[model samples]
Target: MSGTEALIEAAKKRAAYAAVDEFIRDGMKVGVGSGSTVVYVVERLVQRKNEEGLNITCIPTSFQSLNLINDGGLNLGDLNRHAPLDVSIDGADECDEKLNLIKGAALTLEKINVFNSKLFVVVADYRKESKVLGQKWKKGVPIEVLPLAWRAVSNYIVEHLHGKPILRMAVAKAGPVVTDNGNFILDVDFGEMADPLKVLTDVNRIPGVLETGLFVDMVEKAFFGTADGGYVTVDRKGERKVFQ
Candidate 1:
């Protein structure tokens, strides 16, 4: 890997290991997040499961993460079977000072997993940390909508909500990206939102909207991994702590 790629990998590993070490326990139910950074979380969880005999059940946020859990030899389960999980560890695209986050994957399932967990923790590299929401991640908020109502929702967002909405197209395919739930996605740019909770509520006001990437009042804590093999921890109460 290139130097930059290696640095990111190391940061991911550091955050992942720390999250797993501090949160996971024997026989507890865990939520594994999606994305590249979460790859390390799964690996670390598997290592702990085997070496320390940590008998934990894993709840994955997506199909990709489900496969990761299986490959890591972790038992897979669902919220129906294991509601109110002991803890959920997920990655974020951007995390503000208050611990609000922007997610990029199947947020419908992710939200369910997070809300059902007793403790929700986000783990990401330092690049994702921001002074406020929407400051760092500029790709816009990802919203899943009914495939038939995508245009209507987009129109509503632009005309009424004062946001720019674009249908998310599949790069490798000839059509739009189809979510696991058979819905379509729209990436909406609101431009430095003053109130993320309000934005989330406004987006949900439109009909046919399945889920939005904005996670408000959900996360309890976050771990931001620095480049030099350390972590900056932040809690919902706005407390900041560092571990090197």
Candidate 2:
């Protein structure tokens, strides 16, 4: 693999380690998030489930994540019944200097992921920048909305919210893109948001907006794999340390 790819692989491994160390507990309910980086966490959890006999239930952020949990031999549960998860493992598109994050893979997967978890852990490679949430990730923010109010939501995002939003189109198909929540998605770009938390609050206040990808203060900790074959962790308190 190339250098960046190797870093990503290493990051995945470290993320798995972090998840196994902190998130996994005997008989605890865990939340699994969608994305490439979270895949390794599921794999590690599965091994622990078999070898260590950890009896943990997992709630998935998406259908794809649900499959990962099931294939890993972890029990699956719906969020409706399993409120207040013990921990959640996820990946971010970019993390700022303060460890705040910008997520969603050109889609609104971040919404349901954040909603179901209590302690959200972000895992990423070193290349995931620590500048500002929007600086590194130029892709528009992902917004999930009610299907009935997509038009109103889109207009609000563009006109009222001061965003440049486009109806997400599916490259694989000929129709509008659909999210795991069975809702339509809008890719919105606000261009270097000065205050992400305020922007997030404003967007959420809209009638049809279910959630936006600008996650502010939701993450409790972050684990980043560096090129030097080591991992670094940043807690919500802004404390930084290296992890083996």
Which one is best on TM-score? 1
Best lDDT among the predictions, by candidate number: 1
lDDT of 1 at 231: 80
Give stretches of model 2 more than 4 Å off.
105-116
Task: Give the range of the ten consecutive residues with the poorest summed lDDT in model 1.
Answer: 3-12
Error of 1 at 155 (Å): 0.4
Estimate, for each residue in 87-193, the C-alpha lDDT of model 2 and write its tens digit: 87788888887777777752354455466677788888777756776787777788888889988888877788788888888898998888867888887888877
Off by over 4 Å in 1: none
For each candidate in turn, the TM-score is: 0.97, 0.90
What local lDDT does model 1 show for residue 9?
Answer: 74
Q: What is candidate 1's lDDT per residue for 121-202, written digit by digit as tens?
A: 9999999998778788889999999999999999999899999999999999899999989999999989887699999999
